[model samples]
Target: MKILLVAASAALLGLASVGAASAYDGTNCRAPGNCWEPKPGYPDQVAGSKYDPQHDPMELNKQSESISGMEARNAQRVAHFKKTGEFVYDVKKIPAE
Candidate 1:
């Protein structure tokens, strides 16, 4: 009887997993543009840590913006290196010789 019950449960779980396709991408909508943003202070009440990056839009945006700034700086550095064969962290700060 236990073996039969276990087998049935396993089969049900397998079928359930197969049916689940899309996952919640923080906005509750799989598509873009029309995503519903959660009300401020609402997500904080959810049963999770305040620092969970997966659900924290502010954190994710902050990180993405920081990365973009870093990439821009890196691109500038690479361009300067290619043009001058030297790496200068801040070209403006270096006094013109």
Candidate 2:
């Protein structure tokens, strides 16, 4: 009988927890980003800081240029390897992070 009572109490506590969880109206943001319900008409720049990279044309241009440069370098490496049966390696003395 004591075991049954304890189990019933635990079940009631679990249901109460569920009820408490469902009470959230979704405006509040939790640490791990549970920001589902954002306020309507939210501005693109918050406090003069653009968070989304998609909106920044300069950033996109920089990324595209970087990718193109990498591809050109890789193509050069491939061409050199094909012409001479030796792989080219740029031995840069970059410090380990």
Candidate 3:
């Protein structure tokens, strides 16, 4: 009976450790409308973290615009290639200096 009790206690301790290990931290805020933003008066380390979207809204907008433009250009290129089995290139004729 003592051997069985010891075994049961060990098993319970192992299960408890596993449960603690599997607990989640709230760092993953990637769902829709769940983006993390910096809060005022927080610790500098937490406030200045890399994932905060409210740091520079204009920079984010500029980056988004650049990406959108690149994607649009890529889509146009793909459509052109599909229509005419040839790739497109901009061959600028450099003036003889």
Candidate 4:
């Protein structure tokens, strides 16, 4: 009975550790943009400024541009469809034009 109780306790501890490790990596963000690692080349501040090795502005800008352009195009298409009474859109044509 004691051995069984000890085994159950060990299993519970292992489960808790696993859950902690998964809190960040399981998120949607991956690659340089979302993960941070310290680099030695950068300047160290007197106050010890925070360093994020995952800083990739290019990827973030790409995501932002893609999302914004799609949203704007969708809005324009909706407006055009309302005005022209056409529910269908051409894949080859630009939105609202």
The candidate maximizing TM-score is: 2
lDDT of 2 by residue, 4-92 (tens): 99999999999999999978755776654666654677665666545444567787699889999899878777766677677766513
Which regions of candidate 4 fall more than 4 Å away from where they truly are? 1-52, 91-97
User: The CA-based lDDT of model 2 is what?
Assistant: 0.71
Model 2 Cα shift for residue 90 (angstroms): 2.2
lDDT tens digits, residue span 26-61, model 4: 345556577654355756553454553565789779
Q: lDDT for every model?
A: 0.74, 0.71, 0.69, 0.71
Q: Count the clashes in each prediction.
A: 0, 0, 0, 0
CA RMSD, predictions in order: 11.5, 8.6, 8.9, 11.0
10 residues in a row with least lDDT, candidate 1 = 21-30
Q: List the residue pairs that clash in candidate 2.
A: none
Clashing pairs for predicted structure model 3, backbone only: none
Off by over 4 Å in 2: 1-4, 22-35, 40-56, 91-97
Worst 10 residues of 2 by lDDT: 88-97
Compare candidates 1 and 4 on TM-score and give the better one: 4
Q: lDDT (0-100) at residue 11 of candidate 4?
A: 100
| TM-score per candidate | 0.37, 0.51, 0.38, 0.38
How accurate locally is residue 67 in candidate 2, as Cα lDDT from 0 to 100?
94
User: Native-vs-model 4 lDDT?
Assistant: 0.71
How should the candidates be ordered by lDDT, best one leading? 1, 2, 4, 3
